[model samples]
Target: MTPRRRRMVLVALIVLGVGSAAAFALTAFQDNLLYFYSPSDVTAGKAPTDRVFRVGGMVPEGSFSRASGSLEAHFILTDYAHEVKVSYTGVLPDLFREGQGVIARGRMGADGVFVAEEVLAKHDENYMPPEVAKTLKKQHEKPTNSGPLPTT
Candidate 1:
């Protein structure tokens, strides 16, 4: 009922409103965030199973395949130490090819295949995605070789 009490109440309400708005914005941003992972990470079971994420690697030689009369395609992505199978039912980018870097956004299926929603290919031979480069560097830096990478 007092003027001072009314101002205090108004300030409290404003603070509460701002806090709620900030919380909402952060939540939305987190939901849209796509994390990049390497084939090694995926093989180690570190990739998210219920949400979309990104996998970056090279399209190994002879790993890319397409069905006749269909847009469906399959490819094996490799980081040299590990590999992942990816399936995409869409037109690939012009830069897409074997032995090239690529980043695929998708979720892993129960059958251990990556169901890609979108595929991004490297622009040039010298260019590689930062995440992919980092992953490859780490793989090479390891002192011991885990196993031979799968052949296409």
Candidate 2:
């Protein structure tokens, strides 16, 4: 084959290889990406049920429970406006408690429960996860009283 033809073929192959690699990388990224959602989002059916994702919120007071003779725990995570039930079958963090910021990574179960593989709690007294903070803030910012305006 002529040198020019060989060079052209080589360039075409290089381009094809690069394109394939890019596509592969993108696909992997998409598959592995974990999205963060609030309890409100989950209750609204905005979270993906097929993939693992994160749900962040405050564990409401008196909503935590443990199974008898097991490490399994169940809690309700709420942004104050909505709540999602989370089940974790492991030891919880030292700082985990009711009315504190927590983030659970897992997928939604068939029974509408979030089956958490990992549960994370705020590390310090003043340090809430940014996502949890944002979610809480968003919830509080919502208008609770959407009433008709009064006129003079």
Candidate 3:
């Protein structure tokens, strides 16, 4: 082959290799991505029933309970509009408590309860996960009587 033709072939091969690598990386990342959902989403059947995902909301008052002789515990996570029952079989975080923001990672059982593999509690009263905050803001916002708010 001519020298210029050989150089062109090499460049095409390099581009193909880089494109394939990028596509593979993106597929792997998407496979491992975990999404956060609120109780309202779960109730609306937006959460996956077969794969693990996160559920975030407030641990409502009078919703936490522990079995007497086991690590099993139960609680209700609520977004005010809906609630989900969560069961966990491990020690909870020190900061976990009723009326606090929490995120639990797990899958939903056939009976519609969330079986948590891990539970994370907010570090402070004023702090909430950004996803949870955004969801709550959207849920609580009132429509303006005059007109829609101006977009920036």
Candidate 4:
């Protein structure tokens, strides 16, 4: 083949290789991609139990239970109307607290508890995790807490 033809073929091969790599990467990531779902969604059966995913909600008051070790913790995620128990064996975020927002990644157990592989809290701004935002948005319409306390 001529030099020009050879160079054209080489360029076509490089492009095809790059595209194939990108496609493979995207497919692999899809399986690994974790999506955020609210407690309400989980209860509604919208969350996939088999796939690794994230659930975000407010820690229900009176639901946090400390285990013997600093590694294990049990808590509940609530969207006002629904709740799911969560168990995690790892260091929790500093800002993680009851009534605050949290995002836990893991799978649901047959016993109905969420087995969290990791837990994350909001880092900056007024942004809560997407799942928490969804829950709070739903709860906003229902009859709930009146408002913040009236400071003297």
Model 4 score (lDDT): 0.86
Question: In order, how many clashes per candidate?
Answer: 0, 0, 0, 0
Off by over 4 Å in 3: 142-152
lDDT of 3 by residue, 1-152 (tens): 99999999999999999999999999999889998999999999999997899999889899999978889999999888789999999999999999988999999999999999999998987899887787778777845477776899
Q: What is the C-alpha lDDT of each candidate?
A: 0.95, 0.94, 0.92, 0.86
Would you estimate the TM-scores of all the predictions?
Answer: 0.92, 0.93, 0.85, 0.72
Q: List model 4 lDDT by residue over 59-93, tens digit each.
A: 87788998675788999988777888999988888
Candidate order, TM-score descending = 2, 1, 3, 4
Q: Write the per-residue lDDT of candidate 2 for residues 1-152, one digit (tens) a residue.
A: 99999999999999999999999999999999999999999999999988999999999999999978999999999999998999999999999999899999999999999999999999988899999899888888888686888899
Please state every model's RMSD to the true fold in angstroms.
4.9, 2.3, 6.1, 6.1
Off by over 4 Å in 2: 146-152
Cα lDDT for residue 102, candidate 2: 96
Ranking by lDDT: 1, 2, 3, 4
Output the better candidate (3/4) by TM-score: 3
Q: Please report how far candidate 2 places residue 12 from its true position, in Å.
A: 0.1
